[model samples]
Target: MKTRAAVMLAPGEDWKVAEIDLAPPRFGEVLVEFTHAGLCFSDEHLRHGGLGDLPAVGGHEGAGIIREIGEGVTGLAVGDHVAASFIPTCGRCDWCVSGHSNLCASAANSPGSADPDTFRFSLDGNTIPANCGLGTFARHSVVSAKTVIKVDPEIPLDVVAVVSCGVLTGWGAAVHAAEVRVGDTVVVVGAGGVGINAAQGARFAGAAHIVMVDVNPAKLEFAKRFGSTAEFDSPAKAAEYLWSVNPVAGGADVVIVCTGNTTQAVVTSAYEMLGTRGRLVLAGMSQDVFEPNVHLPGTQIVFREQTIRGTIYGSCNPRHEVPIILDLYRQGRINLDELVSATYRLDDINDGFADLRAGKNLRGVVAHG
Candidate 1:
């Protein structure tokens, strides 16, 4: 069958919405009719050759309904609403069995198709890899069941879509990775889609002060709605402010870097904001792989006992954490509705991303028919 999708043909090129051929689901896979796709900065990484190869379908964060289940698929059926997990889990893998499905071995092949030897999408008879193996940019996709979690139909699919990646990643970075405790002072750098949730997560974890650091004035103001106790234009200013208020500790207990483009400068600034024994969690993606992004002093880290850690998928197990995140949204503990600053049709995806680049949106959603 043919479906419309946004395809990235080469680096530094705009996404082209074109009709592509999609194959049916194979064993352990299902056909999904996407309802909403979240415009995440990680996808923007693909546009600049930061991750994944060219001639790929874009979109890793999305929620949809299962149109058909392939042979051997269980616990899901047609009409079931589900959210995509960028990291597909093979339950038998060591990481998955040990409660760390985010590091599942299957993710090693995420840049290509679910099966290393096959391609599920094609255009003009040429193979087109789906970004992260589950291309939600397309109207319909055939994805391995392991990469989707059945979601409650009552919850909005748009909310479900963002929760699958940004919300879960940010929330887990604080609650799980950083192990935020009550009364702790936390600083989150970058108030974009991911950073805002880190602030929300800190609040949820009972942090007394959740400081959001970002240059975008609009995002700084918007951060307050999700639980930011204060906002600053830069990490240096945030660090200065944190030292004044958190006199005893001298700085924040935790610092989470959620900038869209992680750089060595950002890492150094985030590290400088840490208090004694503070934890700095790197949840952002660094585009430059050739140079080291981290340049912390080993002596200070050893003496202060500060920890610098990196997380993928926010150190969350998609099947377990995704449901809990949705529940948090359902109980009003987390605000999923306000996270979406704007929405657009699939055809207007480029405009949505342009708004993201211009810092005009907290999070953009593509509302599919």
Candidate 2:
């Protein structure tokens, strides 16, 4: 059947909205009719060639209902609400068994390629790749069963969609990767979608002081509603205030970076804001092959016992965290509704991303009509 999709033919090109022929779900696959897709920065990274290759569908964060299930599928059925998992965990992989499905081995394949080079969509007989093998940019997709996580029907699909990426990554960065402790002072840089969730995670972990630093005053205010205790216009001010407030520690116990691009300045600033035995978490994306322009002085790091960490998907197990996160939203702990800055039709996807690039939105959801 024909499905409307946004395809990225090459780097630096606008997404082409066109009709593509979608095949039926094969073994261990499911057909999904996407209702909402989030304007995630990772998609922007794909557009900027952060992820090599092209001619692929453009979204990884989305939620939809199962239209059909292929043979041999279990634990999920048609008409079930679900969210896409960017890292498709085989469940038996070493990483998945160890509760770190984010680092699943199946990701070794190039984006959209699963089952040894088989393509699920074709445009005029030309193979089309699906982003992360679960492209949500299109109205429908035949995705690997490993990438689909069953979600409760009580929660809105649009709200569950953002949890697939930004929410899970950011929240897990603080709650899981950093292991934020009670009474800990946490500093989160870049109060966008991910950073705000990082702040929420800190709050969930019982952090006493949560300082959110961002250049945008609007975002700072928005983040405070979720969990931030204080806000700063710049990292320097945040560092100064930390020293004044917590003179004993003199800095934050954990710092997380959530900007679209992790620059040398941001890295170095995060380093400076750490207290003794503190850690800085890199939870954002940048040029895939670029050097981390800032250098950490080994002498200070060794003595202070400061640590740096790099994370993907916030070091979260998506299959597990997806359900837990949705539960949090259901219980009124995490406010998924407010995180939606705006909503747009599928055809206005480019405009949604434009708002993302301008920092005008926390998260923009595409509602397919």
Candidate 3:
């Protein structure tokens, strides 16, 4: 069938909304009709040659309904509501079996065609890969069952869409990876879609002080509503304030970096802002060219007992964590509505990303008709 989609034909190219063809799902795959899709920075990373893969569909975080189920698929059926996980997990893998499903073994391999020699989405016969193997940028998608999670139909799809990536990653960065505890001083860098939720997670985890760092005054102002006790326009200023408040420690208990463009300098700053045995969580996306600058000396890391950790999917299992997060939203524990700063139509994808680059929106969604 023919479907409309935002395709990144090449790196540094603007998203082009084109009519594409989708093949019927094969065994173990399900066809999804997306209701809403989130404009995540990871997709922006793809656009700017960060991932090195182009000619692909552009969105990963989305909520949709199973329009059709393929052969040999189980636990999901047509008419069921679902969310797309950027990282597909094989439940039988060692990581998944050990409750560390976030690092599924299958993730080590590329998200290739579900069936050999078959392409799901194509434009004028040229095969186009879907971003993260689950392209919610299109009106309809055929994704592997492993990457699709069942959700309650009662919840709104737009709210459910953002949780698939930013919400889960940020919230998990604090509660799961950072292990934020009662009365802890947590410093969250980058108060965008994900960083804001990191603050909320810290608050829920009982952190007494949630200091948010970002260059955007509006985003810092926005962070306060999500439990940020203080806000700063720069890392140096944030560190200064932390020292003033807790001079003895000279830093915070935990620091989470969720900026769109993470850097080694940012990591070093986060390291300097940690007390003894403090943990620094790097939860942002970055390009490969900056790989040489990601180092920290042995003395500071070993003697101080300070730990630095890199996380994907916020270290939370999607199939399990997605529902738990939705429950939080259902009970009014986390705020989803406010996270959606704006919405756009499929053709306006470029403008949506411009807003993301300009820091005008916490999250931008593409609402389909």
Candidate with best lDDT: 1
- lDDT of model 2, residue 10: 84
Which pairs of residues have clashing backbones in candidate 1? none
Stretches > 4 Å off in candidate 3? 108-118
lDDT of 1 by residue, 3-60 (tens): 9999999988998999999999889999999999999988888888757777789999
Model 1: CA > 4 A from native = 108-116
TM-score of each: 0.97, 0.96, 0.96
Q: For residues 147-258, what per-residue lDDT tens digits would candidate 2 score against the true structure?
A: 9899998888889898999999999999988889999999999999999999999999999999999999999989889899999998889999999877776799999999
Per-residue lDDT tens digits for candidate 3, residues 173-283, read 999999999988999999999999999999999998999999999999999889999999988888888887766667898999998888878878777788877889999
Q: Which ten residues in a row have the lowest lDDT in candidate 1?
A: 108-117
Candidate 3 least-lDDT 10 residues: 108-117
Against the true structure, candidate 1 has what lDDT? 0.90
Candidate 2 vs. true structure, TM-score: 0.96
Provide the lDDT at 24 for model 3: 92
